[model samples]
Target: MMCFCASAKNNDIIDVTRIQHYDTILKKLLYFIDYSKKYTIDDINDTLFSYTANTSPFNQKKLDANYFIKLTLANTGQQDSFLLYTGKAQRYKMYMCDSTGKKILLKNQVTKFSPGLFTNIPYAQIALKKGEQKVFYIALEINFYNWYLFDPVILRTADHAYFSFLHLLQPSRIYMAITIFFMGIMFCMFAYTFALFIRNPLWEYLHYSVAIFIFMVYFGLRLLNIFHFGSLYFLFYDLRYQGLQLLGHMLILLFILSFLKTKEKMPAFHKQVKALIYLQLIFLVVNLPLTYTNTYNYAANIAFDIMRVLGLLYSIYVSIYLIAKNKKKEARYLGAGSLLSIFMACLALYVDRWGNFDELLLRYSGISVLIFMAGVMSQMTLFLLALSYRLRMQEANRIRAVEQLQLENDRKELEKYKAIIDARDSERTRISQEIHDDIGSGLTSIRLLSEIAKVKNSESDKKELEKISATSNVLMDKMNEIIWTLNSRNDTLLNLITYLRHQIVEFFEPSNIILEINLPENVHDAPLSGNVRRNIILSVKEALHNIVKHSQASLVSVNFSFDKVFIISIKDNGVGFLHDKITDHTNGLRNMKERLTSIGGSCSISSNGGTNIELIIPLNTYPV
Candidate 1:
């Protein structure tokens, strides 16, 4: 709305005609330093006021002191009112004087004037007629804590000033819009990372989310500082820049530590980063006191600048180490992102420091701020990628572990099956050998006796034929015993007991020995292997045969019971034999002992007035 190309000389009289619509009058004004803070309008004289060639006349000055400025205006055009604006100040007083140096208008304790919508500045309105001149005196005070490096004073026609303020707001509005967009993206990333932390409970996700939150708070305050929002103006301005920067750097350091698992993977580097973080915190705490007291402010700022640069460089170096030395896939993305962010951050800092050469560059090209935001966004995106990659790798490792465990189980199962098959083959070979040795020899003897009987046909031959009939019956009984042992269905302890009871009843029926059976009502019916069952049955049969042939017992008792083992006791009231007198030819006792031992069982024989044979079968020795 207003042009800013107008120029004026450093003279006491500012010709209003040369001021097209709006122009800075900083160079045309005379200034005086008030070290004692006792200066009044009456104390100000032409001799005390001095002109400076510096564009920013207040630069590098102590903000605690009062500054007095004088401007004289001459109206060479028609009658008009103009606005005298100071860009920013804590407080100021304006005095309007005539050519005689007598005050005509006095405004006391003026803080700010809003000449246009969204534009609030310290200003004074001066009225001038054709061929009229006025001298204005301004006493400016600045707060030490809220000092600016440059202060501009501008003069413009009232109507033009209003429109010029609107024109100046255009770039700020664009920048604010972009900032809001960036904040939105940051908020989304914060929510995403926070959600991830909630799900996985990993330190990296939590640290990243907190860092994003800090970034949001810093940027939000920055937005408030830019807009100079009503009540929070001082609060936003005070915390917007250096203090938040220190806090953000600390948070970023924490995020880096967690994201890289530095404590576990890089212990030495972890300690170095931790010390750097502590130093940043120390600087932040020290900076507050120095800034508030306006003591050592420049030195503190310089120190903070150096620390920030070093911290950023160290972070970049760590990222490079992870990428190159550690050879982490995720680190490559992180390193690339960090490099881009650091480069953009340095570029933004450079632009901010030097772009002050042009007022438009300082006001309109918020490109520096945008570039810095782009850097943050890029870093955040790559960090998310790194996190995703890490999670995927962890999931893949879990799956592989599960597959390995399953493979181990399958291998064990295959070995178990092989053992079972080998045991079955050994049992079959033993059965075949027994059939060949026992049954084959007996059948050959019967065939030879039948042939001899057919040739002789005498009484002796007939008697031999009857012997052949008895031998056939014993062979049939032995064949039935082998078949029963081979049957898998009889591989239970209950089945073995049932078959033994039937045989004991039949054996005693032909003898005068009274057999009394005692068996438990409740049997566990535990499983027994074929080898175990066959050995147990054969041992019991041998004991019974011994009882019948030699014991000469009038009464016999068989008792079956179970505890941790199966127990079978056979007691007889008979003429018991002495173990010392029994010869080595007593093969029945030796065979029974050997058979029981093969199945992890034991047999014991004891004699007092009678003989008792006991068989102990350990249940756990066989399948249960």
Candidate 2:
């Protein structure tokens, strides 16, 4: 009975045959020993049979026999051909052990491996004589890539235990693990950026999409064995990979184009870029069936590779164009990142092709993806920051301009008001001068005439003297009233209204028109400018005079209130004339309007059942 077993390394071994002979033992081993350091193979020779040593350096202590070793023998002088098998291309050697255990090599055969078939290699093998024990060690020579293939070797015991264990712990397995870890991190980063972009759909959203797709594709391919979903097994190998690749390329291109404003510089180039991206998509769709059919896979692969290269070129072109045309910092960042990713991808693939650093290349595929994502993220951040900065600046400038315009308008309006006030003051001075000159001369002459008549002492002369004196006194009072109206200082709406009410009451005491006052009783005495107060008082006096003069009705009402508008309305139930005829060309009505306007107040007069003149003003603004 034979036993079958497995180890922690997951090596499968079946102990069925005690003695086994293999015409050739071929093994393709990949090891993690530093490629920079070389391990030695010992070619031992025994005294019972002399053997030749291989020309390479001999350091048996460095040789890991369990990691790689095989035994094979054939007639040394006759059959120089043996069947060889290896997964990939590598270098190998043959060594013979003599009776004294001094191993020697018959030949060193280094050859390239063609995948999937057995081929013949011409190399001399050792021949064993009767009653003599012959030993031979055929092993792979480690190179810079740490990959090697073995020739056919005969073993007394055929066991797959060691090989399977080494395979389980291969560098590829570590690479796969590392790839998964970084890919997870990349996926997280992409998701984070995507979420931010969704919150704010800035231009960097394009990069987020491309980065997510790249990581998803890579992660999906890596976790293939876990899902074990058939038909989707070779998703990366199918047209979906190419489709995603093209999509990523198009997104990057669009981002660059939009970022640099490239269309402004070269409109024709933009069209070409669009067409090329579209063609790339079309080809990806066209090649799907070809990729699925085994007979056409090679052709599809070639086409896909070509498309990838072209896409790379297109990206490079856009980047270079942006750098050359715009020369902006954002464009530079985008270009630099794009070029770096493309270069890394190509360099990794090239190293794999050169049969060097296979493990490093696989490991760096994930790293390259990470670098690419980081670059894209950096570019996105820069763009978003720039856009935000620009928008903020624009908003600030717009606000500043609006404020400046408002200030200028206010300044111009102030100047206009000043000019109007200056002109009005000049006119007032002229009118005051006329009142003082003409009226004072008339009164003086009348006073002199009255004195002469009084001196005459006749009855008629006395009456004449008294009449002249009364006329002079009336003129004097009129001058005083004019002076008071001109004395704008200390004038206020409240003071003016109080003075007008007093004058009306006194004037009407001897007449039939009974006047009343109703005003804002609780208003604080906030100061009002002289011109505003004078205008309001004069307007109110004129309205009252017109009511007493024109309206025949006896009952009259004067009301004042503070509401949404500060209002003063004077109404009289009299035989009111047509308001339109009065307002049409009436100097009094026009003067009233001018006075109200000077103080930013408005006045309206209407006579329906009664004559009503209402003046409305805004408090703290219109004159007060």
Candidate 3:
């Protein structure tokens, strides 16, 4: 058996002949802490250095300080060129020195550029000859506020370097492919849900669609950042992304509350969820300054992590509660989807945090992101199902409500018809009573007078004949008045005015009185009830009779004007009388006043400037 000798300590010369493709040089490295940032290549001595014992390849120790590394390589084989990869760093400087460490042959500075699929990994080419040795001094600057994974230092031959670079790129390529696929799914979901919101204008649908859009943007920016595709490189690794995440969470909570009607159905749980949402907002507000100023970053990160955990727990609890207590299939679907999503999300977070540093775990890192996306898609599908079910229920309720309203309308219409029929019967009874009280008695008296005239056949009988003729004329006039009142065709105010003008002219024709009429032009054909029209006409007739008999006025004027109230004024240029001196005409005036009052109208008589009679009728008080 052949025996091999290994280096006793780190910082020992590494033999390049023994180094294979993609070999890790971390175990053979030594580091020095530069607390003051004042260390130079000449100042870096072996006395100030320490071996990286039991340290991770990521070099996570003393993150607040800058680090310098010492490496020595010996070429004892036919290979004349090698490649050195120093992983990721904010900025670094490499010093190439002779074997004696007395003079620096070359100095190279490398700084991080925007990350990309094939760039951002810092590497250097090394040229060597047989039996040649070289020393390389590297200085690394790290920022404590940013979390980053520093990969192990790798050594490879020229031919194997390209393959090693491709190997390192495998995870990013897979992650990019998965991100693109999920992005498509998220866009489709957003479009569909947004269309639903537009169609229904429901707050729940709007919240869900907006939440989907926000998450889509978040994932899209993350994909772009990973590939370094755009100029928005600073947005991904800063407070903006965190702010976006918080906003997305808030929208999701709002969606849940609206979708489930939690305030109405689960008041206690609603309050708890509302409180959680408020706390998240507070954290979001507080984290901005902390992150921007690079102050209390660790504390802020811890608080955010706690909030996320609490949010996840609350979501799970509510979903489970709904599934257990509610019998709705929508609730069951939502609960199952929520639980699965939360599980996958938790797995994703855990894996992303720990997987990047381990070589074996790195292969699955991209899959974790895909798993989270899958969970989201599943949850979205279930939410849509629940929405469809709710829409169906709402449609059913709407149809029932419409049917009930139609039935109520039909009942009201029937009652209206009954009321109309009753009113018609009452009017007929009133007409019959009037005919019996007035017309029947007049006809009986006329018959008795005619019988008396036939028996006597003398001068007194002639007087009885004259009396019968006058009585017949009076009966005919009363019959005409009754017929006019009963006619439905004369129900308009215009018709009433026309009839009144004709009656006034006829009554004054026999008398030597001049009649002057004043009436409004273009009067609206407002409806007048039969009872109202009859009462008004009678009042006007009584006034005119008093003017012809008592006032003995040579000139009379009748004026008509209308607004919401109808006014009729009759004036006579005759000898005016005081109230005490008008005893003979008192009954006639009283009748006129009584007639106007019956139709919710008022009559005022004054003796000044001849007798003036004013009738005021409020049209609104009478029904059409």
Candidate 4:
């Protein structure tokens, strides 16, 4: 019995027998192996007889070189046909010979596997007669990507050889179906995450989508046939088959780093993690270009094994560290999901070797790889669950930020409304003060004149009437001034200057004092707040009035300048008055000081070179 057959058949007998057990049928045949790279049909026939190594019904382990497997079929059975079943390999050949060492032609058969689909198994047909034994040798050039362990050769009646071939195809067909299903699911996930990227435009979503896409390609590459493909195809095939795991590790690291905000939250650890990612990238870059080279192609199998384990360990460590540091959201999603992914991936890693535990796993076609696909499905499902939850949290935070911004806008709008109302009330108060100080005094003078005129004759009556006319006209002028200040159209500094120029020209036209006004060159149309305008107008008017009434000055000068502040200096060539006496006049210098203070301004009175009243008001700012 050969390694591929079961052992219930006779050990040391040659008889025409029909065996039912497929494993026992071929496994009981004798077999030997060789490692000669230059072995041909003649070499296999001549040298195969001297070899003495035995393998079971399946060769589940990988060999580093070309191998020649010789099986002596002792068909002591009524079965007239021997059907050999094996997975597709990069290169293979089979020859048959008898005890006389004469080569006999056997039908060369191989299932034409689809390019990217895992759909078929290859078989070899060897015809036999009852109680006739023949020796067959299969020369295999092992390519890890397309190799699958073979079961014991099927021993069937000559009429049922076609059914035996169909039986051999059943396992791979199921494997192809399950793999396509898994691929479909992974592609769906990729599409879903791509949709997420379109919605958010976040880096995390984009990175995660790319990582999932890589996984889809990785799974596809694992199932595709690598034989007879072009060199470039084999180059990529070798990279994906051997080093794609390295790339996956790097992508996984990057996805975690970006998803967790590790750079902002854990700078030092993030640097270490970043270094690991770069190292894995270096391995990928180095290996990708060397995939076709003999040294790298041969050595990649071992190198990526260490690379995968180390990369996964580092990733898990980073996740655990993040969990410890109380990054609750990231920990909640990444910690548990990453562990599940790692557990499942690790489980998948050993699934192909499950034959050690249950030989039936290897005896069947798709059981081991199907379990691997299930493991992949579990991993991706858990990962997607975690990612979806994280995205929900991100969406919530975005909505919260929008709400906070809206609340801030509402607050500012409320403040603006309040400021407008306060301006209205302050203007009303200013109008009231103008009426009382200017119009009311004018009315009082008219009333006094009327009273004095009642006690006098027609000549005194004429003088009183003239005085009443003057006071009445002055009151009317004061009313017009109040109107001018209250009008919203006169809110600019230029308007204030034009109005002040008119008032100063009119007030001094009849006086002996010469008024010299100096203004800034750049005619600013900048807005003046009601409060600033009101306080400035009132203060300037008071200072000018003081100069006209009591300064006894011959000349007065007013200069307006702006730097960090708006400044108005009114100086007169008059004798100085005591500061104490000035304070006694509440609506005079004291009122000027009070008004300036109200608008974040100040006033200073100096009696040198005339009474110099310098008023400084801050130029207010408005939001953009």
Candidate 5:
């Protein structure tokens, strides 16, 4: 929206006053004036200053103190409704009186400047000269109406025109009623929500405290219908209405900061917020003694304007920071609400400063509605933000409950697997002990008998006996290995690693292939469940067996390392077979991957120059 400008033929005055001296003149003129006092153009007599092309002073010869200035004002906005009544001789009555005084129009001996209903054009201007220097008190009343039931009148001087309106009873009452009733609802809602912040009772009290002051300000404005309380009602000794407005705004700022959890989001902003409130309170204390002192007002108002802009700018900065840092919904709500309120307030201040709204129809009402609506919008936005926060908390609780249920189910499944593994280990231990004591001993005895028979026999028989001894010895060794496989103590990670190292070296002792073993540091005495150790051992053994049997490798290396996860690599300088065929086998690679997966690990084989097998198992999966 653009700034409203006063349209006047004195273009030089309009330019200088509208741009530079506008706010200064308006503030000076308005601050000391009693807003409730009725006034006419004569009250601002212009006979002392003359309007001429050369801008000279008024000619004293034309001045007459006894004569009253006459001013005829017409609605420049819309004149079709009043055209018929124009150019007709008619009598008009005008008056000025406060809320308690008798009607001054009825007591007038003879009203000066009462031009008969326009027997000429729609507008007329007459200068009045009163002998006294004191400001005249009068009203400019126009006996005119529109379909909308507004009594539009205009106050006129030699230089400018202004409109006066009879205030609407319905729209004013409706807004006041809505504001009061909903404000009550807001209080209760705030109380309920505020109890949540009572852990820090200052915040709770701050919300309630601010709400009380705002309630009073709204109520006071509403009561203007019955009481002729002036605009500076709060600045007076017994009734400081502006103080209420100040307190209300300060509380609102506090409530928003606390509501959005800003203390945690931006600690420095929280400190500044406290300091600002304290500073406003100090200003209030100082203002109390200087209530009637006008000497410092110029500096004070300027300071006030500066602080308002800076404080609001600080709030905006904090909001941007919150949105960027946390991306929170509440921050967005507070930010948008604050911006709307500040903009409307600034616009209203501008209008009151330089707007000639008295010359227009329904414009002041539009501005009033904008201010009221801004408040309503801010309140509603904050309410929804609080509601949304409550909903999110409920959703989080539901998700946590679901996660807890899933964890319990997983625990039961883990216990089932553990029980089965323990039973299988016990059975394997019994079978391994039986084979080592019974079957291996029998094989050893049979081999010794065959060896003794060789000395008693002839050449051919002796050769056959020696062959039987060699066959029996080989059978005993195979049986011993089978027994150890059934009942082994290499169930922990440390024991399994040691056993695997010995077995690999022993298996390749008679072979021509060069074998290398690389064991990682910190591998010994690691915490591992028996089942996980068994799986790792089986997979490693299977891979080595494949290398020995199928792979025509000259050199082989096994390496292990572990941290968050354990890794083992078995590489061989052998002609690698196609991966598709190797992976499809039931006896070797496929079985190895199955064993690795059963223990929650993964296996992959890759080859460029030779074969490289990699196994990765989570250290956390091994019961650490």
Candidate 6:
């Protein structure tokens, strides 16, 4: 119980607009607890007679029964109106007493008490004349541990208290707005997490979403109840608010359990956690309405205290266990959040238990929940971060899996194509061997027979025999060329250059011409197909033959260069011919152009002091 007196002597009238602030808490007043709910103002003053000073903004204590408080106000010089406001009373009724000891009702009713919400705490305007004084008394019926702020304002008139009190309330209202803003943030997080739960259907997301929602519920209820918004006044003073707190704890525990994967990682610990949750649930069910069952119930308090201690221990144990098991990320988050939450909870419980010993701490009991709220929001935020990391990991794993499957399929298909190509190459080898060994040998034998016949024949038959010999030699050379093209070992560009060197050296050895072959030392082993190789080799042979037979050159040079296009340049120190002369059918230069064009290549011929020929082949003409 607490009361105050705010009376000052006035010598003369002052300006009506002049605002004065006063602190009434330092005065001595009388109060007593009426255990039987039967105390009148007269009975409390006469029988109890115990006076105490209310020298603080508020005083709080456990009122196990009815409590009675009294206050006095007087005007020694001028008649004035005074406003008195009380805050956060569970239940109270007020009556004013005169010097003659006549009592008059000033609040709700004499027989009933108002269960006050935050803003609706009862207040009254007391009018006093010069040298007049009055005493006001209230009987308080507390159903819970709460605070009483003895805030009284004396004014020249009653109307100025609203504006003044409104000004005084700005700080608390800002505090309330901050809490509501946090509530809105938590609401958005709840919506997002629930959406994640819908899409991914994970236990952690669902539990975290529910836990965040519970925080929003708790804050929103407090905000509404403080402002006396809607029907929150009734719920604020009822057992339902307690249920929300219980649910918040339960869901927080659930989130921890799911994220930790306790069943998979530590089965024994998981079972113990489940048992703890069950015990809390059972205790909550039994503890409801327990205050109404007894005048001063310690059963609920004892049970809750046990649960709170056990919960704190369990959270610490789980956090440490996770860290030891190498889940450091989850461990740190859980540990930080759990320690903060448990600390705040323990602080609140301690304040409830020991508030009667200290008015200053008890007065700020409502602010304690913000700490707990921050802890819960922090825990949920960490869980959200963990969930994001898990999802990214899953995505990366999925992409890796897809790449592995594609690689397997590609390997199998490549093997199949390789087998088919190898078989085709084998069949071509067989045909080349048959033509070279069988047809070529047969042609050589036919030439030998024709030559023998020519040696034995008369003059008229010698010509025919010689012609037969020449035709056989030509057919055998063509067969040998076919064999050269079909051989796999001769498919590389290096082999082509070697063969050209040998053929050109052999052909020009019987002539007066000198051959200079320039090839790159780092010659690429560019692969060539049978058709492309045959055309390129034949074209080079034709060019060399033309130079020896018609250009009459003494020196010839062949240069090969590689870039985006493969280049082969042939030059000779010979009498140069006109473009029309080289274009003649006998020169076979047109054949070279046609052969290069067939394989996405080109041929160029030029003449200055000597004959020069260029064969240009696109690197993409044949696969490397």
> How accurate locally is residue 493 in candidate 1, as Cα lDDT from 0 to 100?
87
Better of 1 and 5 by TM-score: 1
TM-score of candidate 6 to 2 decimals: 0.80
Per-residue lDDT tens digits for candidate 2, residues 1-624, read 111122212111111122243322232111222122343445221111111132122222233222234343333222223333232233456566677767677754433222222132222333344333344455554321222222233322122223222322242455556556655755665666567578777665656556455646744564442222122233334444556656766676676566555578768887888888788878877986676653465567678777877877877886676567665666566666667666755654444323343345343234443444444444444445544555577689999999999999999999999788667666666776787788777888888878887987877678767887988887786675665565444345566566667766765677687777787767544456556666777788788778778788787888877776568888888987774466436878889998888777899988888888999776676332
Model 4 C-alpha lDDT per residue in residues 1-624, reported as the tens digit of each score: 112222223342323255463433333444334333454456443323332244442232434445555565566655676555544344567767756777654554643333232244344665667667766666655544443333444544342334433444443565667778888998898899889899878776787677778777877765563223322344356566556566655666677778777799878877998898788778777765654544354466556656767866876786577567665664565666666666655665565433353334233324555565565566557667778777688789999999999999999999998798668857766776777678777677776766666567587577767777676777667667666666666768889888888888888998888989998998667777655677788888888888888889998998988887778888898997776666536668678888888877899988876799899877655211
Ranking by TM-score: 6, 1, 3, 4, 2, 5
Q: How much is 263 displaced in model 5, in angstroms?
A: 4.6
Off by over 4 Å in 4: 1-26, 36-83, 98-101, 104-121, 128-148, 155-185, 221-238, 284-300, 350-394, 408-624
lDDT of 4 at 599: 76
Worst 10 residues of 6 by lDDT: 8-17
User: How do these models rank on lDDT, best leading?
Assistant: 1, 3, 6, 4, 2, 5
Q: Which scores better on lDDT, 1 or 5?
A: 1
CA RMSD (A), model 3 = 17.2
Put down candidate 6 lDDT per residue, 359-379, tens digits, no spaces.
232223345656566666676
Q: Is candidate 1 or candidate 3 better by lDDT?
A: 1
Q: What value does the lDDT take at residue 50 in candidate 1?
A: 70
How far residue 383's Cα lies from its native spot in candidate 3, in Å, is 2.3
List model 5 lDDT by residue over 1-624, tens digit each.
Answer: 111122222321211112211111111111011122343333433222222231111122221122121222222232111111111122233333335533344243232232322112222222222221111123322111111111222223221111111222332444455555655665665565456446446563456445554654554453443222122332342224335656766777677676666689768878887887787777767754443344344344455555556656765665566556656676666666666666666665556444555434434233454354455446445644654575588689999999999888988888888787767767778887777678877878888888878777778898888888889877876566555555535455666677778878987899998989999777746556556766777788789888888779999998877767778899999998776675456677888889889988999999877899999887654652
52: Cα error in model 6, Å: 4.0
Best by TM-score: 6
- The candidate maximizing lDDT is 1
Q: Give candidate 3 regions above 4 Å deviation.
A: 1-11, 17-21, 35-41, 53-62, 77-81, 98-122, 145-147, 152-161, 172-179, 220-241, 263-269, 288-296, 324-332, 349-364, 367-371, 395-624
Q: For model 3, how does the per-residue alpha-carbon lDDT over 475-558 read when each residue is reduced to its tens digit?
A: 767777776766656668899999999998899888889999998987767878778988888899888888877886899999
TM-score of each: 0.59, 0.41, 0.55, 0.53, 0.37, 0.80
What lDDT does the true structure give each of the candidates? 0.73, 0.55, 0.71, 0.64, 0.53, 0.67
